[model samples]
Target: MRRNPERRAALVDAAIEVLARDGARGLTFRAVDAEAGVPAGTASNYFAKRDELFTQAGGRIYERLQPDATTLAGTREGPRDAARVTELLREIVGRISAFRTGYLALLELRLEATRRPELRDVLTERVRADVEANVAHHLESGLPGDATSVRLLYLALNWLIVERLTLPGVFSEEDVRRLVADAVERVLPAVTRPDGPGPS
Candidate 1:
């Protein structure tokens, strides 16, 4: 096994692209080597097995999807109201949707996880922790919505993303914006809940 961090990272990224473009079936060590433009056998030196590659790719996708300081700052400065929540959700949706290959590769990894309990456990734990963190953030940030509101948006918005990615023609960009607004309106209170952070 190799201990080259940069090389391993590049291999993982290459794996993600291969998964997105060709799915799990097409994700061979040779395929990754080819995608990375590295010599044949290079990916094998970095990844001991395909499952290792899968888990690394999943973690990398999350890394690539994370928001930066500006995006994080936007969350705190916004008004603590449903509309603000909608805007935040819209921004989040946009950010996640923008990483087309990452999301698509995630879908591929998820399918692979079904047959491999080891991969399933790793992915489930990571995703579940993420969901819990979102719920906790909603509650602590004084966001207008409750934990339930956050969960609802999580469910609806993710499906909307799937639709947008898998079938772009199904809804126009304007339609997505409207649907996001409507989801927030339906799930969150018209006025900020008394228990939540007061509107700025």
Candidate 2:
């Protein structure tokens, strides 16, 4: 027998809250049960194991990321003005900043994945698909279909943004944005050119 739909959702939400507040290490079924106003056994029943709970939490993050990726998919630029790529970058930095703890949870999940080949495979595929999907959206005109380069670019940008938080006082958001935009303009000149001229 299943719990009420509302209760199930409540438990899941509690799980996320626990992750966000205390990280994966603190995500005990008892903690979630209390947060969800359910009995411990109910939490156990819903998530058979700690691994299951962790996987579910990871899925929640994946669910949120899907819309962001889909919205920007298959375009050389996102919905924001190309001139405002810096602004978009800043926004991304801010959004990620708000989820620092959640990001840690994801990192923990990744380590767990290494021990579980099935989970590792699942994560690998998701990561590849995500990069490919986003790269397609962020294409510049005349860009070579170099899948390897595209993958590297995605990895580079992802790491840079992750560092933005970890590396304190490195650069302001505007500075980082300008640096990224300028680099893109230089590297992908043909695609990023204004109606005027390419990088001189």
Candidate 3:
């Protein structure tokens, strides 16, 4: 097959939109072609199989949904405290809010993976890599989180994101902010000075 990066990317994005709007069952090549405003059979040319399309869409969603450079820079420069952690969490919430459809599609991908062992394996590796990356970032930022703490925080934040996306208005943004602050304070170790006082 010919390699066209731009066309493949457009098809993958179209798949994301279809998955988000129509669910996995509705993610067909024709649907993607329609979503992308391309002639019929275009998506099929890029993705020969449904599994390939789903996999590419999942990967694309991860790339597209990642926090921007500014957010990462802000997190890096901010004080390494609970409040800063809360701010980081807030940034996550903001991203999820902004990309609600893409995130919803991602959740669908997770559910679809349950019955497809190959897809499950691929997704497992992706999730594991994401966790490891987050752990590294936390350590690099001087955040008080070990691997376990980072994993816990990740799970908690994911749960919150899932809940918020699934049931809008179930928790206000403020509520999520408070929950993130509490989770950060609880999961992360207290920062203490060697020759001075610690957090009260």
Better of 1 and 2 by TM-score: 1
Candidate 1: deviation at residue 96, Å? Answer: 0.8
The lDDT values for all models are 0.87, 0.62, 0.82
Q: How well does candidate 3 score on lDDT at residue 137?
A: 92
TM-score of 3: 0.91
Write model 1 residue lDDT over 73-147, tens digit each, in one string.
678886667878888888998999999999999999999999988888878987887889888877888877667
**Winner on lDDT (1 vs 3):** 1
For each candidate, give its TM-score against the true structure.
0.93, 0.69, 0.91
Steric collisions counted per model: 0, 1, 0
Candidate 3 on 1-200: residue-level lDDT in tens? 54899988988998998999999999998999999999998887877689998888878888987777887777888577667777888888778768988988988999999988877887888888889999899877786556787788888989899888889689987788888888876775464334423333
Best by TM-score: 1
Tens-digit per-residue lDDT, 1-200, candidate 2: 37576776677777777876776678898999988887768888877677777666766666554545543443334443434444444455566666765555566667778786765776777677777765664444334324554565455566666666567478776667777666555444554555634322
TM-score quality measure for candidate 2: 0.69
Ranking by TM-score: 1, 3, 2
Which candidate wins on lDDT?
Answer: 1
**Order of quality (lDDT):** 1, 3, 2
